[model samples]
Target: MWHELFLIPFLTGLLLAVLLPVLGAYLRLREEWLAALAYAHLAAGGALLGLIGSLPPAIGGVGAAVLAGVGKRLFAARLSGGAGYALMLLGGWAVAVLVAANHPLAERLGHAMFDGQLYFADAAMLQLVVAGTAIGLLVLWRLSQQLLLAHLYPDFFRIRGLSAWPTQLGFDVLAALSLALATMSLGVMGAFALVFIPPWLAFRRAASWRAGICWSLVIGLAAYLLAFSLALYFDQPFGPMLAIVLVFFGVLIA
Candidate 1:
């Protein structure tokens, strides 16, 4: 278990355990939590398409998500209240399933994407997770003030003769990258669970916004560690175990 094979995958999951919940906290703040699932589904679809096209799955997945994030700005007015994200989720799911049904390899890859292949994660995944985490934290730190202002005081930017387009676009790309990478590592529902569950509990229980973020990180990290151990011990799939553990944590706190 302590070999390089397990150690690398564990480290990959560790980075994501911390990163996904932080991203989730911000998404929840903006009332855009659906972006997580949308991006995950899209990444899964892109990954399957990539496998068929002989492109690197990560490249395909990330490329598709980044494109959607950038393109979202164009349709922002027409698709209010997450309707666009919901559409993306449904479209991506349909594409992935259709591709899987038609292609033998895609079918196997689709199961892996949904069920997760964390124990088989290689050093390349660790590198990607490490890079993604660093970039995500840096972007979040630099844009944190603007992001809060944009959400909490929507008029603040408009009143100050500032366009929040750059900030919104930057964060959208950041979120797309984070969710796509997480979906690849943790599977669709597993990644969405990490993004959805911990921040949810924190929002209800924490005293302040910053406190909610802190509590979200703590809950996500704790649940991820427990799920990793249990899944290994029981010889079960890690993704479902993670989602289950997170829901159980939510139940306990609720």
Candidate 2:
């Protein structure tokens, strides 16, 4: 049942990775809020999944997401870039420590959270995935205008009687939820990388939002397919291999 729930986030992340940049661009978003939203969703999803698994989901997912978000908000104001990278490293270490401390349950849940043997996926996991995907899509559709407005001109949004704070909070919650779900089913490493990398690369290279999304989707699918193939051939972990594939392509693109 849980494994079935995994597919929803996997497909959702893939779709969002491909479409968000383009959507943001279309709506004239100036900041990287869309990207931030995506990451937040991934974090939230991870937390939720942890909770479902009877693990300390908040400690790892919500806690880490909040910490990472706060750190990014703080450092980004001072540093030009690299805040995300720092957060990623810090979050990884934090999760590792927590996992190590929990040993027994961690070992079992870790395999479920990271290894994700797709062949063994069950019906319940699929249902969860579908439900999550539907909810995410609905939220995205409903909030599109507000999100765009907030991104483009936060001050104006405030003036027009729209509170940026609420929007931000909502986005954060949604992001965390999405992340938690994806992490539970797809494996943490693969899910996180999938959420972050492709959009980033597309944003870097593509001139328009549509172009960026199209490129991102192509790249994301390619990365995952390559990763899966490599993992199968070498008997390596799928999540790490997927991340490596993304890195390899990222470097090549760079």
Candidate 3:
């Protein structure tokens, strides 16, 4: 399995294993983890529409997610907290299923998006993941302090006569892009699992914010590798296996 054929997909997964958890740590901090599932579901819908229109699925998915992220920020007053994400999630799911129901090819692609087609990931997917990971890391590095202050004190920037929308919007777009790519590679629930579980576990155990991030990264990477190997060995689906492995890890730690 460690041959030329699997190299690209493996590399894609590895990069996501590093990036997603870092994003997840922040999402968990902001208590906005539901955004992962919302963005993923939207990506699935966009991907299905892309197939129907003969466009690249990744482009459609990422575009839709980024739009939603931007819109959420712009309408922050009305779409506050998880309400906006919930709306996106339901709309996305409805769109995806409705599209799949009418088109045969879209049905298959939609299923693949939810179930995951990691082994079928091509070079384009790997390249996209590489670029996304790099951008995510760079932006996260710069926004670390602002994000920390925002999450810890919600009013830190506001009280000081600064708007927090810019930072929140930036992170929102970054997270939307990250989850879209992960969904394309790891399936909807697989991506959500990575964004939710590791950080949940890390927050319970870590002594500080930095330690939480480190623990989240370690937990995500370990589960990802184990899940990948186990799925390949057992000839099972990757997404479900990854989720299962993560849950088991969560149980062990909890």
Clashes of each: 0, 24, 0
Give a tens-digit lDDT track for model 2, residues 1-254.
Answer: 12435444345444433333333332224344333433434354445446556756534564555555445544655744544544555555455446545666555655655564443334544555566566766776666667767776668776787667665555544554455455554566666676666766777898875577577677878887676667666876666877788888888887
Candidate topping lDDT = 3
* Candidates ranked by lDDT: 3, 1, 2
Q: Per-residue CA lDDT of candidate 1, range 27-53, in tens?
A: 998999999999999999998999899
Residue 246 alpha-carbon offset, candidate 2, angstroms: 1.0
Task: Kindly report which residue stretches of model 1 are placed more than 4 angstroms away from their true locations once superposed.
Answer: none
- The lDDT per prediction is 0.91, 0.56, 0.92
Weakest ten-residue segment in model 3 by summed lDDT: 1-10
The residue-by-residue lDDT of candidate 3 on 106-217, one tens digit each, is 9988888888768878899999999999999999988989999997798899789999888999999999999999989899999999999999999999999899999999
Who is ahead in TM-score, 1 or 3? 1
What TM-score quantifies how close candidate 1 is to the native fold?
0.98
lDDT of 3 at 119: 80
**How many backbone clashes can be found in candidate 2?**
24
Show model 2 residue runs off by greater than 4 Å.
Answer: 1-96, 111-120
Cα RMSD of all models vs. native, in order, equals 0.9, 6.0, 1.1
- Whichever of 1 and 3 has more lDDT, that candidate is 3
